[model samples]
Target: MIDFQPISPLQRTWLLELGLERAFLARLPQAQPGGQSAPVAAPAQEAAAAMQTAQPVERHLNDAGSPSPSAPAAATDAMSARDQALAVLRKSGARPVAAAPVEEVVQRPAVLIQPEKAQDMASLLEQVQACQECGLHTGRAQVVFGSELLSEPDWMIIGEAPGTSDDRSAKPFDGKAGLLLQAMLNSAIPNASVYKTHLVKCRPLGNRPPTQEELAACRAFLDAQIRLVQPRRLLAVGHLAAVALSGRDEDLETLRGQALTYTDAQGRSLPLVVTYHPASLLLRPQHKANAWRDLSLLRELQNQP
Candidate 1:
């Protein structure tokens, strides 16, 4: 039988820093038959449900037109990505993740998306499901193109590649991280749908970050998404995607707390914001205050010219 004990916040941090947390998660079974290994879609209904559960806090503009109370004053920081995911699993009384075999290499036939013909959303969805540009498609149970688009929301949100829950549910913001993301968006961009997507469509076998080749293979789809959404603003959730979308090598910390602009290949310039991934927030709740600042900035920019 597995034993989990209560630990202080400091102890939890120490464990994570020592890689004990990762080691624990690693030792877990490679598959979770009844656990959250399934991909989840970011549901449109989530926005409504989140809004109902957690009514967004009101923010009034000051004379200078800045949002008041930028972030939560205090938040307990005992959770990390693994802990959050595991918490959800434990809560559901779900089975543990499957034990994965060491040194498993996946091979897949190379295939590509027809960028030009993917002119509309419907065509793109059709093509994305069948795409095998990289090895990702071989592992994912389904493709989560985007949960669902609601008429080109004001902001186009992009995140890193899929995790187990995302892969299992084929939902952009599925899982515990997704739960937090929905709360963030509902509380912040109450009137708007996040229209969140990923750098890569398919999961990277074991929740691993997508490689440059994989991201490159999927760039056309993102560009097409940009064209289709034509959003006034852009929000990148994590460091990899923030750097990838911006085509920069700067560290994520340096990129935070600002609203920059990114011009697409078609010369459309959109206001952009960067913040910690919700998964990061689940792992490090302390950053939620900072993420609030980022989302606040996104909110402020979207209201601007």
Candidate 2:
């Protein structure tokens, strides 16, 4: 037997919203002559018929013209299903189905590899001479693969990117800023060789700031260098280097005079000392005092056996 319960005012209101009450009542399954199940029309066919009528459901009123609970169980169920179908259609309106046109997927080419710290730097440099990993590689006069100390250096210096001079010479930090960096390194670790590198191998256009996309592309190379060198302490000079090492964008002041720790690929925490970029001190001579304090702290950490 069909479950015929009295409809609630809420159900009647909802059925009226779907414009399905009349059509649903018309298509409800009727009892067969024999004691067999009545066949019902497919939901899709009923939905199409309701769409064709497109007329709003008429409201039932009492003698005082107030809404009444007269909608049947079959009507309520059909209305609920129609509402659910409408909701699904509306939600998927923005997505493409099988009927939608397909577009071709264009894959980007892989970047050229330049293994500067591998067994041989010259062979690796030759390989990356025609690199096109990113747009910067195309614009650069020469790729600054970076330099490493021949000796077992206790400290490593990581900089932001190749400046104009570094790009010209195919070396890192060859400009005036590089000179200041060398001086700072000499004072901090006199006997220790200062290996220099740019976070990005290629020079950016007009020495403009490196975009986040470019940094992401070059991060793996920097990480590789850190692993190869295995320095006791790392000196991150400049905002980009500091952020790369610390995984945060804390201010230079908060970063200075404090020893921060970074986890290496082997799950080992490496000691990192933050300091003002040589370029910064050159521009703001007044902050030299703060830089000296940071340098002092780095020396103390290095001396720790």
Give the count of colliding residue pairs in each prediction: 20, 0
Please state the error at residue 78 of candidate 2 in Å: 89
Model 2, runs deviating above 4 Å: 1-130
Q: Put down candidate 2 lDDT per residue, 1-305, tens digits, no spaces.
A: 22223334455445556564455534434434454434344244444444433223223435764334785554545454444434433444422122234588998666457554444445455545545666888888888877854444677788888889988898888989989878876797677656778788899988886888898877766776666666777888888888889887888777768889888877878788878888788899998888888888878887888
User: Which residue pairs collide in model 2, if any?
Assistant: none
Top candidate when judged by lDDT against the true structure: 1
- When summed lDDT is taken over every stretch of 10 residues in candidate 2, the lowest stretch is 92-101
On the 0 to 100 scale, the lDDT of residue 144 in model 2 is 88
Identify the candidate with maximal TM-score. Answer: 1
lDDT of 1: 0.69
